[model samples]
Target: MTGLAVVGVADDTDGPVVHLVTADERARHCPDCGARARRSKDRRVTRPRDLSVGSRRPRLVWAKRRWRCDELTCRRRSFTESVPPVPPRKRLTTRLRAAAGAAVADQGRTVVQAARDYALSWPVVAGAFTSHARAVLPAQPEPVQALGIDEIRRGRPRWIPDEATGIWQTAVDRWHVGFVDLSGKQGLLGQVGGRTAQAVIAWLADRDQAWRDAVQYVAIDMCTIFKSAIRRVLPQATLVVDHFHLVQLANQTLTEVRRRVTVTHRGRRGRKGNREWELRNRLTRSAARMRGEHVDALLDELSNLPRVIGAPITVAWNAKEDLLDLLATARTGNRSAICCTGSTADAPTPTFPNCSA
Candidate 1:
């Protein structure tokens, strides 16, 4: 824009049409001091394709000039001249750099495509975008109460070679997300939680002390590592096991009991074993397929099973109900409780019993 002026357009023997621009000045500046100076040595014209201005193709036509600094305190003389809109060391224009950044941020396009579109070299486009994103994106804020921790996988390709035959297999991996509360709202905290404990701990360590102190309660699944991380990070906070995890555990226990009962019933009627097994399978599958009110009704019917094999089923059902009761109790009284032995403990630091059902 400064030195070059577009003159005319001509079609090349190759496909693309090219625009010609001419450089006018021999002015130069000191690279170290950024002080204006006259050209001490003149170089050949370096014409590089620049960003498009409107519909017209733009070209950068300029000479690289070497200038000598007059200041004695300066480290050395003989520095390259600076371009106005383009970065000091790079050949691409400021507008092209911006377009490349937008491509990465907004369109989720690869750096290579962005570079090609802007007529810029890969390094120039990449460095500018990276630098700009680092400057503009805000730092992670601290969590106040109810932080959630999770993990995710980064950069790993979807496919990997199997160890046995060296055949490519699709891999399923995860990365961790740690949510922090900046506003002290319990509900607003920790939406991102993943499988890794170390990632959760590191995220907690990044938060400020004031935010840690403001936390009164933390709701998490029964992940031992997550619980341990919470204990280390926020020792004073109340820990409440999430209801969803408890329900899942109860459902699993119920399903197991159903499987055992179905197996025993089929054994008793030994004649049509295959047909009986298939029927039982259909029933089990139907129970699994049941949703919402139907699931609740099935659970209720399971709860009414006679005291023979139904003891475990009843226990699992009651456990689920008790879990819901605890959640309601906490919500009504605004007090947290630790679940232990199919019951809620009132103690601040309650010991949880090893009860699967």
Candidate 2:
């Protein structure tokens, strides 16, 4: 007999069922009284589901041994024998339960899907996955140095009927703020309800003094509310604007310039056949990323247009390109590059000829 002794065997409609008992049996000690008992109290049998053994799902009917404490001086009662494969009051073996947990957590499948895959109940698989997650998750969060804050839209704008005023009131909150610990193994710390300074302040104030002191920097978008909140709560932490929002600002500037230039020259809104309108994306693209011949040809085309259309578009496009160059130079930590770029940008350029009637 291996760890399992086959007491009997039977054939079921699904597969072969085996009745098993513990193979290794020696002197048993009462857990509470520390007394060895040779006398038998009672016997019981349980059917526990096990993992598939060679393409056949094993159903085990386990005959268990129960013992009574022999010491009268100790406040002891009868206890049941524990087995390695199955725990008390559980219908699935440990290995089977672990398989269900792995199906849900590791494979990224839903609990319902895992239940169907493992031939177990939904609650059973879900509970096992939850327990596995709790056991594997870090006992305590690692310290965070740099934090990131951002907001995401939750749902559409909604209106609720107001009975007292007989009018519909618009819902207020449509955004959620996520706080992330950039320096920690787990990026997300928590999420708050609103994007207001008060909400952020309250969350930071809840942390202990040491945690607040440990924070070295905070990265956020160009939201004044978040900046103000960090200033009030974590005053020592350096506030840095995130890169995505900086790119968004550049895009907004390009869009405004394009719209203004379009309306000024074309005397109407931009549409097809408008050269400036068609090259909006090309105008925003970095010069290095664009094909040398194509970008030069496009700029040459702009220069050949009328002074009013060409001048404004050329200036804005040059500014966008120069901005990218300046950012790249700054990343390399070269002071000379910064000074040279600044000088080049400030230098005077040939002005557009007056086309006044």
Per-model TM values vs. the true structure: 0.55, 0.59
Model 1 Cα shift for residue 6 (angstroms): 5.4
Predicted candidate 2 versus true structure: per-residue lDDT over 203-313, tens digit per residue: 887777888898877888999999999999999987877656666687778778778877877789888888777877777777888789989988997888777888877
159 Cα displacement, candidate 1 (Å): 16
Error of 2 at 217 (Å): 1.5
Instruction: Give the top-scoring candidate (lDDT).
Output: 2
Tens-place lDDT per residue, model 1, 99-179, is 788787678888898887776668876886776777666564444444444344555546689999999975634444545
Residue 41 shift from truth in candidate 1, angstroms: 5.4
Per model, state how many residue pairs clash. Answer: 17, 0
Cα lDDT for residue 208, candidate 1: 80
Worst ten in a row by lDDT for model 2: 348-357
Model 2, which residues run further than 4 Å from truth?
A: 1-10, 16-54, 58-131, 151-207, 333-337, 340-357
